[model samples]
Target: MNYITCSQGHKSTGGSNFCSTCGEPLQNSNHYLEPTLIGIQPGTRLRDRYIVREMLGQGGFGRTYIAEDTGRFNEKVAIKEFIPSVQGTGALNKAVELFQREAVTLYQLQHSQIPRFWEAFQENSRLFLVEDFIEGRTYESLLNERLRQGRCFSEPEITKLFQDLLPVLSYLHNQGVIHRDISPDNIILSGKTGLPILIDMGAVKQVTVNVATNLQTTSAPRGTSIGKVGYAPDEQIRLGIVAPNSDLYALAVTAIVLMTGKQPEQLLDQYTLTWKWDREINLSLLMTQVLNRMLAPRGDQRFQSADEILSFLGLRQTNPAYSTPNYSGNSTPIYQNPAYSTPNYSGNSAPIYQNPVYPTPNYSGNSAPSPVNNSGCGQIFDASIPVPQEIKGWNWGAFLFGAFWSVGNKVWIGLLCFIPYVGLIMAIILGIKGNEWAWKSRRWASIEAFKANQKTWAVVSLCLTGFVFVIVFLASLGGS
Candidate 1:
C-alpha cells in the first residue's frame, strides 16, 4: 500500500516531517480510506487482522474508523489513525510515540465512567490505536435533542450525572492527569442507560513533572484549547493550568445548560447577572449552591476540589442528616435549645482536647460522658439527641439567653416546690432545654438546671391558691 499525498501535492516521503517538494509539513492524505473486511479486500492488509469498514469521524490531528478485527472472530473496534509528517528524520517516530502514549494513558484508566483502549499498531506508514466501540450519542447530542423537544432536565437528574463523574475526576486528579478539554462533545452518553462515559484523551496532560506543571501554568500555546469556549475555565484558557477543580467548573456549566436547555454561550453572556429561565425543575437549595460555587468566575472562588463540592452537596459526607451550617450565607438553620449553651473553650481555662472540637465528637466511652464543670456553668442537653459538628458554629446569642436562665433557676430553685402542679411546671420549664436554647439534650439538662427553683415555685403556687379560696368565700356571703 502506498502512502497518500497531502493537499500540498507532495507525496509523503516515508517518515519525514515536511514535504520534499513544498517544504510544508505533509500528512497522509489517504486517511479517508475505509476499513475493508478480510473476505472482501482490494489490497493486502498491514497486519492481516483488521479490515477497515468506514470512516467514523476526523479531527485536525487524526481520524476514527469502525473496523472489524478478523483475528478476533470479526469483532468490531474503533480505530484512530495518526498521520505522521514526511519531513524530519524521526517525524514518524514522534508520531508513533504519541500514539503509544495515548494507548498507555487510556489503558491505565479502568473506571466505568471512561472508555477503554484496546490496542495500538502501525499500518501502511500510519499509526492507529484501537478502542472499545461505545454505541452511544454524545452529551452534545443529548443537549440538542432536549432543546429541540422543548424540554429540560431536573436537578436530581443533573446530580446523578455529577455523582457518577465526580469519582472519575478525583481519580484522574490523584494520578496527576488532567483532561484539559472537558465539554459536552467530549462526553458520550450511553444510549442504553443514559449514563455518561468520558472520551478523548489526546488533550490530557500528565503534570507529574514540576517543569511541565510550571510551563503549563504560565503560558498555553495557540490552537491547544480543545474545550468548548464557554465551558472552559478562564485559567485553562489563559494559562494552561488544568486542575481537577477546572473540570468541576465545566461539569457545573454542563449541568446548568442541561437543566435549562440553554446554549453555553447564552448562559455565559447572562452569567454576570441574575438568570430567569423558562424551564421548571425541582432543585434543592444545596445542589444549586454547589453548582454556583463551581461556576464562580474565578477558580479560587470555586471549590478547591471535587470532594469539597461533594461535601457541600451532602453526598460524600457519611452522615445522611449531618448538614453544615452556612457561615457566609443566610440560609443556615437556627437551632435553639434554651436550656443549654456551647462551652466557652476560648476562656482562661485550658482547652479540653476534644478530638473533633468543633465537629461531632467520637464517643468511644461506655456511656455518654457527664458535662464538664466550669465552676457552675456547663452545656446541658437532652440525653437522646445526637450532637453534630454544625452545632459548633451556632449563634452565641442563644447561649447568652441560656446563661441568664440558668442563673435565675439557681436563685429561685425553692420557689418551684410550693405550688403543686404550677411548681412542677416551673421546674420542668427551667430544667429542660427547649427550643429557645438550641440544646439537643434539653430534657435532662432542664431537670438539673432548675432543681433548686422547684421549692420556691411550690410555695408561690400554694399562697395564690389560698388567696383565691378566701376571695370566693367572701363573695358567696355578700351575695346571700
Candidate 2:
C-alpha cells in the first residue's frame, strides 16, 4: 500500500488526506503553510544530516523548514533556505553572500535567550542554515489567545516581561549587533522556562560595520525592509537608520499591543503619529513613563540602552555571590507576606525600603547594596540623600576627567557628552557627581579597585587635554 508521511514525519498506513497519528493534513500541515518559493520536499535529507520535514514559513529572503538532525538522536531543528525572490545570477550571488554573513554572525552568538546555531551549508545549488528548534508558542499566538479570552495582559505581566527580555537585548547590544525586527511574532515564550526567546535573525543588522557594502552594494533587494509595519519605529521604517533604541521602540509597541489586545495600527494615530490607549486600563505612572520613553518617535529621545530601562525600574543585576533567602521549611513563603521582614543573612541587613511595584531584595552587610529605589520617586536624582556606597559618592577623578571618567568606568550616561547644550550640562554634572552615578550603574569588585581605576582615568584625561592645548597653541602661533 502507498503510504503518506505527515509534516511531523509520522507515516500513515495508506495515502490518506490527513495524518493518522498527528491528524495534520497530508498534502499541507496546519502547523505551517506551503512554501511560495524554492524549497525541499518533505523527507529530503540535506548535507547527509538534516532531514527536512516541512516548511515552517517563508519571507522575502528565505524559507524556514522544520528538520530532524539525523546525527543527533533525530532531534528537531529549523533549517533556513537562502532563496531570495530577486531574479538574475548576480542577485542570487549577493543574496547567498548576505545569508552566509548572517549565519556566521549568528553562529558566534552563544546566548541562552537566542536560538542555538548548529550549521550552515550549501547543497544542491541552495544555501541553508540549521538552528535549534524552539518548542514554544509565539507571542503573537499568546496575544491572540488572550484576546479570545477577552482579557489583555496586566501591568505586572508586562513589567515581568520587560525584566526578562531586557537582558537579552543588553547582550546583543554589547556585542555591537542590532535586531532590526523586534515584533510580537519574533518572540517565543519558552514552554519550559516561561522566558521570552528572541527568534528570526533574518533582520539582524551589524551596527559596527558598513551594512551597505554587504547587502546593498547596488540597490537594496525588494524585501530589504525587514521589519513589520507599525511595530518598527519611524527611523527604521522610513530612513533605514536602525539604532539600539529602534528595537526598544518595537518592544514598547509589542507591550502596548499585549496590554490592549489591539494591533499597533489601532493604537497609533497615523495622522498625529502618537500612541493612544484607553484611560480605563489604569497603568502606573512609572510604567507609563518607561513605555513613553521607549516608544519615543526619535531614537535620540528614547533611552539609549536596555540597562537604562532596568535602572529606571529599580532592578539590578543579581550578584552571584549573594544567595536568595532560603524558604525550605516554611509552608507559607516569607516573600508572599509583606509584613514579614527578610531574615538576616549576616548580622547587618540594610534598612528595608518598600517599592510599590517590585519586591526589593534585602542585602546583608557582606553583600553590596541593592540598586537605588526609584519606584515611587519621579525624579532621576534627588539632592537630599547621599549617594550609595557601591557607587563611590564623590571623587576628584570624575570631577576633573568629566566624560572620560564616565566612559572608562562604563557609566554609559557619558555617551550624552556628544549632545550640544545637553552634553555640556551632563558633562558638568558628571564632573561633579560622575563617580556616584558610575558606581550605581555598574558593579565593582571592591571600593579600592574602583578608586584606583578612576584615578588612572583622571591622569589620562589631564594628559590628553594638555596635548590638545599645546597643539592648538602651536597652530595659532604658526598662523600669526
Model 2 Cα lDDT, one tens digit per residue, 318-390: 3222223343332221111111112222323322212222222322324432232222222225555344455
Choose the strongest candidate by TM-score.
2
Per-residue CA lDDT of candidate 1, range 158-268, in tens? Answer: 777777667667655433355656777778887765667777763422211112223232243222343556777775665444545668888887788788777666655
Per model, state how many residue pairs clash. Answer: 44, 1
Q: What's the distance in Å from true for residue 275, model 2? A: 1.0
- The 0-to-1 C-alpha lDDT of every candidate, in the order given, reads 0.51, 0.63
Alpha-carbon TM-score of each model against the true structure: 0.52, 0.57
Give residue 271's lDDT in candidate 1 (0 to 100): 38
Q: Poorest 10 consecutive residues of model 2 by lDDT?
A: 332-341
